[model samples]
Target: MSKKHLIDRINTQFGENLNAGNTCFSSINKSKQVWWANIHLSKFADEVHLLLAGTGHFLWVTLPKDFVHNLSETFKIREDKNAVDLEISADKDSRYLIDVKSGGTGFDFRKYVREEVGY
Candidate 1:
């Protein structure tokens, strides 16, 4: 799926307050276009939701806002872009990453996703 689809998924589950060109999202559906000197709802940065969807792997994570508070100490600033790269590890062999961008911040999300169809 593309970036718009990701944002649409979020909007579909949540509400319209967090939509494109508006609302409290640092960036919805990250793109290489925004990888350099991007802009969005940085003002509402709190509780990061790391959403990944592709291939056979679909993972979503909720990180504490303070997770990226300390740059040099906790996170790594990407020399390649205007963003930071984060590493999220679930186990020794399984690790996820937030590469070149941070997103989906703002709003108290008790639930950011809802299943349209069950397994």
Candidate 2:
């Protein structure tokens, strides 16, 4: 599908605020158990680093394999109200951290797949 088509699909499935950002295109692939989201966080935020740092919590819901490889490479788990900080490195070395918050939505892989991929 086209870039605009995919972005529109993602936004409709996820939320209207879902930004495609600088990375105009999204690569969808398949893996064992989940669907991954590989997009630039900046599209949803003004400053990625600042937003992550300010928020004590965020959720990292791993997408399926196809989407996983498309996302930013590295992810860091910031300090949360109930969890400790951690880091997950991707093969491509793209540092993309998703902060966890107490009030934030918990990790839901299936929901993401259903929304983004229309599974």
Candidate 3:
């Protein structure tokens, strides 16, 4: 994929919702035939930086701290509004990354297969 293609994919998924003073960054690995991009998703409380990489046929995404926080907040709000048993367990896997394959309409942690962090 070319740089433009990568950028367009991010734009299509995120639109112009990036936080103020933030922009996307990208690069290509000619040796491996891979393309990657770094983008920030805008939120009312914080900004989440995501890394998207495509290897000709498939694409993957890596979440940052803001993603975890945002997800946690979502659960917290849901629990507060409704009475239900809810639990969330997330480890600080600084090296954690997953493919955009099949989680849900968005990044799916349940279906994320560990790449290398653990066997």
- Candidate topping lDDT: 1
Where does candidate 2 have its weakest 10-residue lDDT segment?
A: 47-56
Best by TM-score: 1
- Tell me the TM-score of each prediction against the true structure: 0.43, 0.25, 0.27
Candidate 1 off by > 4 Å: 16-44, 87-119
Q: Write the per-residue lDDT of candidate 1 for residues 1-119, one digit (tens) a residue.
A: 54455557666766633334332222223433222222222422555444444344334434445545454443454555534443332232322232333443322222443322111
RMSD per model, one decimal:
8.5, 14.0, 13.2
Ranking by TM-score: 1, 3, 2
In terms of lDDT, the poorest run of 10 residues in model 1 is 32-41
lDDT of 3 by residue, 1-119 (tens): 54355445556665634322332323334543222332222332333322233333323232334545344333322333332112211212421222221221223343332121110
Q: Is candidate 2 or candidate 3 better by TM-score?
A: 3
Q: Give the Cα error of residue 106 in candidate 2, in Å.
A: 17
The lDDT of each candidate is: 0.38, 0.30, 0.32
Between prediction 2 and prediction 3, which has the larger lDDT?
3
